[model samples]
Target chain A: MVLAAESQLRLDANWIDYLLVAFYFAFVLGIGIMARRSVSSSIDFFLSGRSLPAWVTGLAFISANLGAVEITGMSANGADYGYPTFHYFWVGAVPAMLFLGIVMMPFYYGSKVRSVPEFMNRRFGPTAHLVNAISFAVAQLLIAGINLYLLASIVEILLGWPLWVSLIVAAAVVLTYTALGGLSAAIYNEVLQFFIIVAALLPLTLVGLHKVGGWDGFTDKVAQGPGGEEQLSSWPGTALAGFDSELLSVIGIVFGLGFVLSFGYWTTNFVEVQRAMASSSMSAAQRSPIIGAFPKMFVPFIVIVPGMIAAISVQEIVEFKETGQGSVEYNQSILYLMRDLLPNGMLGLAIAGLLASFMAGMAANISAFNTVFSYDLWQTYVVKEREDDYYTGVGRVATVAATVIAIGTATFAASYSNVMDYLQTLFGFFNAPLFATFILGMFWKRMTPTAGWTGLVAGTAAAVTVWVLSEDVTGTIAIGGQGGAFVAAGAAFVVDVLVSVLVTVVTAPKPESELRGLVWSLTPRKDFHDPDEQELAWYQKPTILAGIALVMVVGLNVLFA
Target chain B: MAERKHEAGAFDIRVFIGSLLGIYGVILLLTGLFGTSDADLAKSDGLNVNLWTGIALLVSAALFVVWSRLRPVVVPDDPDEG
Candidate 1:
């Protein structure tokens, strides 16, 4: 009631706040300029010259994925749905990251492929490679556009700036640095952005918790609200029991999100893996995602807890919950809290962090886009004998083109109410069945190139059909929202696996000699670690670190449950 | 090889960024602790979010600095060894 009576929230940014944000932008651009000299070759531009240590690459790896959506949307989910949102991190991300580090990094890193599509080229031949490259390039462009739209909207709301102003400013800053420095620049800024984000959000959480009288008081207050105990409990009920209006079955969350989507994104998505591949050594490459897992586990506190706080503290959020009216302005949850809580200079730092996150996300997508376009598409199809500088030039040109395309896409994405949800649905269509192709291709020497193409095409078709059908279809079989996405992805994965196996059996397999280092069974059994890594303490070992991360993930699940 | 080592030890951006944040964080933390008026406290719901947040940022900066110190980039003798 008190919250309802209160007027609309407005950001009270002072000169200090503006100064802090300006400093952040200046620092990021400075880092880009500083990193420019390091990127002499296409390899350096695309892969950080493959020289960064695990820690740098590791933080950047996670930060690449921590876009504006992760900060804003996850918290919005927290305010609306509560603890189940943590599943995105714990089940949906951590295990898959560990899988990438321990099992799959050998193929990705050991084989010396520049991009994910390049890896497909080696395993599945030219057709599959082309298909993957085109789809990924298109997807990255859409994502960049959506991120631009979301960030512009947030900036407009928070700073009372026009949408076009934020869009151009963001695009200009991102394009200047990204084109100049390449992946190394993008990565360095991502690491910097990560720190800025942690710096910004940690205080918001602490202050929020303090305001609501700590965790117990916050929980009690949320329990008294509209959603009640369901919102507080991480495991709200059985798999069949619905949370609010959404049907999130255990099968859907575990199989669909945890298995298909997570594996597809973490293991195959070049944007995330490019960071790991940039590591200085094979050992560092293996350890990078593992190192990332530690911080990835704790991200929910900064992103999600703020939303939980707003659920009880803000009336607009409560009213949205009660009326079930026009879609919950869940995306505004973080900005709302900052406006309500942080002081002038601190508010600037927080906004800078938010801006940093948006830029990092866009930069990651753009850099990946450029690399995939240059290496996978241009090198393979356009001209094979061009100088390295020529490819690098193409990469720069692609970066500029990609940014323009993303800006155009952002204009289109403006029509979408929930950009984050729309993006996830888009990912479900593209990335869900990709894991099946990757998994079967890597593990099964029997899997043919034709099978790979067939599986991918058929799997994507299955996912798309389900999504389309879900709109008109209803009743026991009807899949909708996140649950629908999970089911659709699961179905696609199953279809992909079955089709690949069947096709592989029917068609002749690639020779074992040719498959060496590309397929798991045919590849040599070389140790993943270097001599120096072998000498490190047990806790420092990649396997040990990943194990620890897994245990921590399990512990968090139990604690939250 | 010597050039590589020099590159490794060269101005680490992480450390530079960390040090900057640490310095700024200290300033903000001190301001939050000592310079806050009653009106400022009222605006923030009686909790010094800035003070707490600044402390957290400082700690984060310290962690980044320490991580860089402990695992200073190691360039292999053979550039291809990685």
Candidate 2:
């Protein structure tokens, strides 16, 4: 708990602070309520009538991608890693855009499908769809809960309020906005919140930077800490750094993280895809990803700067090594910096920004959760009578159900670990398996439904086995560490694919007509055309330009290194 | 499949590069000029405000250069529209 001065801020946490928070929530809810009139059908409710302008969709796209956990987590990582972590955004996500735009987007957008799972069904089968959908939904729930839990915990820490009170209050605000708005409401609020987040963070960073001697002083200070010089300056020293990994691995991570991740995200992640479905045209949907990419490029600045500053401010860190207190918790660095540096009003603004960050993440998860549940699960299974009104109304109910589940799960998440770690672990668990399924389904023609489904279930099971076995087993035998889960899940996916492919070949091929319908979604194309013509068109000069860009970026980085 | 023809004439590569140069050039220059002296830049007192501001300038300049060079293509509006 904060001592007197911080405690006083909470006691004196006037109606004005409440009013500011309330107004933000109200604005989000207002957009949703207003949009409700336009949502006369399931597509309209889930997607927003497919009439969003490019800029609006773009802003929302970025907003949804950023959540409170991202803000807090990035800030924490920056504090630990210094400027190299920023490369994760630039080096990590940018090339991804190129790959996604040039390679994956053509196929995904070509599909004209509502969900990634639906596409899986086309390529693989119903089994693949069911496995992907369930895993995705489970992952979404875990992530949403973690995001909300973190938001609440951060608010309490800043305000010196009770944790449960903070959790309930924050949950209520997010639920109100999301419940009222759906995707349209969430995206609009995200844009508004994005600005607020930037405004709050930029000034606070300046102040924190000022408190430190600036960037050089900050880096120098961090350089002096135990192993600080080596640790602060270098990359993750893992395969992800692209140094030790094979060329294929490096290319794969870059392509997988950037292109595959983005394509998969935009195409599959219900939260983001809802924006595309809601857009006014096919072009608008395409533009949304491009628009969203702008902020993604800059997001590192928001999360990384404070963490870097905190590293410099180590003297004030009250090193818990002596007191059993400050043992370098990765996520708390940003919040700690704010508490130590900012005065009252600035602190309040920072808290608000933090909440905004958390809400953005939670809001995306919630919005997407409603989508998957409504479109894939509820509409498909429960309702044979699926009218537009019926599905739309069911979407609202699912939104509520999602919110309630998130709140309950978040309480448990907060009790165990900080929001960022919990989120990353969960993300790795779900994303690793699903990523393999989608990648194979898109690229390989022979990937049967049995293969897709087997890959998903087996991949998840492998990840779980690692999770379980890691506790008792010694080094090589156990997979119970940070990087282990990804390795496990990834291995499982490969195994599943191998088994499923064997089964598929041994069985029989589906009819050409059935294959034709799916070929559009699975293969690359400008429109629903023959796969052969599409493949030919995909070649030509664009590949040359893309190849040039890749060489230039790598060549420049290598030369500079 | 819809075929897109790339008309090099339609691109403004020069302007893009020019803008990138102007922005990043300013950032690089500012940090180099106004950022902290090399003596204090290495010390652990705190953020060398001048240094960070300088680095920020350098980064912004680099970003500008990259952005300008890779001009985003805008689709031409249909002339056949009634």
Model 2, B1-82: lDDT tens digits are 2433232221222232233324333432454355435443333124443334335434544564455357442322221220
User: Chain A TM-scores, one per candidate?
Assistant: 0.92, 0.81
For candidate 1, the chain B TM-score comes to 0.76
Candidate 2: Cα lDDT at A291: 55
lDDT of each: 0.77, 0.56
List DockQ, one per candidate, in order: 0.42, 0.04
Model 2 chain A: weakest 10-residue lDDT segment is A2-11
lDDT of 1: 0.77
Write out the backbone clash pairs for model 1.
A44-A49
Instruction: Evaluate residue B25 in candidate 1 and report its C-alpha lDDT on the 0 to 100 scale.
Output: 82
> Against the true structure, what is model 2's DockQ?
0.04
Best by lDDT: 1
lDDT of 2 by residue, A126-239 (tens): 677777777778778878887887787676765677767787888887787666666545655666566657655775577666666676766676667543664454234232
Candidate 1 per-residue lDDT over residues A476-536, each given as its tens digit: 4555556656767877899988999888888987778777778887776773446576687
